[model samples]
Target: MKFGVVVFPGSNCDQDMHDALQNDLNKEVQMLWHKDKDLSNFTTDDCIVLPGGFSYGDYLRCGAIARFSPMMQSVIEFANKGGKVLGVCNGFQILCESHLLPGVLMMNAHRQFVCKNAFIKSADGTPLKIPVAHGDGRFQADEKLLDELQVNNQIIYTYCDKNGNITPEANPNGAARNIAGIRNKAGNVFGMMPHPERATSSLLGNVDGVEVFKFLGLN
Candidate 1:
């Protein structure tokens, strides 16, 4: 499948995502500028990616301003039509700000930026080591909404240990339920704090993250 990696003004990881898709995954991928309002070239079957970075220098809030980018309107429309949209790190913040996903990414409970390799486990019991870099990585929402997500099986990834154990010590940003990633009720939109692209290559020290792309049926 083709991939469109969004490039916001301060998006530092766009090229990394592009390279991973094109070189590692051998997929058709292009950089989509944030200011561009058109997404006519991308079909519903194609995947749109909002890569991680400090968009707008993290001025107002993480992803608060980037959500207003001209291209986001089209991204929203595309996702509403059952298109696949993946948001990584700051991109995940953008998705939450845009209401494409429930809950919000608040400041890390520890009041510090966290950058490290974290072990995360999918609901299906698959575990992977992915890198997470962010300051506002905590996820917060109403208790009812959290309950709804659990009942719907929308929670996709949670911080875990090598043994696939979800424990408080494994929680890097103090996210509720140790959530590292989640999908929308429809499952077409996904948002995650970890940088899967960076971990896809063995040259980077690990290829555990390749499982995420393969989960999308792209690998």
Candidate 2:
């Protein structure tokens, strides 16, 4: 399936996502600009990616301004119609800001921007090592909502040790329950703070993140 990488003015990782899809996965890709409103070329079978970056220079709040861009309206509509949407890092913030995903990404408990490789585990216990770079990567939500996400199995990834043990010490961002990623109830929309796109190539440190895209049918 084709992948569309949305590009906002301050987005720095759009090319990373594009290259990962086009070169590594050999999939058709499109660069969707923030000002553009049309997403007609994409369908339910395709994937729309909101790449990582400090959109609008992270002003107001992370993803707050970018959420109102013209193209987001189409992105939201596409997701509502069963299309797949993936948001990475700041993209994740945008999804939360847009209410496409439950919970907010608060500042790190350490009160500092963190940049490092983090180990996380999928719900199925798949181990992944991905890079995370953000100040507002902590996840927060009400206890009831967290329970609902857990009951619905919407939690996609959680911080874990190298051996796949889930523990608070492995949580880099102090996210609620050490959550690293999550999907919507329908499982069409996904969001994560880690930079899977940055870890997809073996030329980088590791290729473990490729499993995530493969899980999404990247082959």
Global local distance difference test of model 2: 0.91
Instruction: Write candidate 1's Cα lDDT for 1-219 as tens digits.
Output: 789999998999999999889888889988899989888888888999999999999888899999999999999999999999999999999999999999999999999999999999888867799999999999888899989989999998899998899999999999999998888998889999999999878788888878988775556
Q: lDDT of each structure?
A: 0.91, 0.91
| lDDT by residue for model 2 (1-219), tens | 888999998999999999988888788999999999999898899999999999999999999999999999999999999999999999999999999998999999999999999899877866788899999999999999999999999998999989889998999989999999999999899999998888878788688778878765544
TM-score of candidate 1 on Cα atoms, chains taken together: 0.97
Q: What is the TM-score (0 to 1) of candidate 2? A: 0.97
**Error at 121, model 2, angstroms:** 0.7
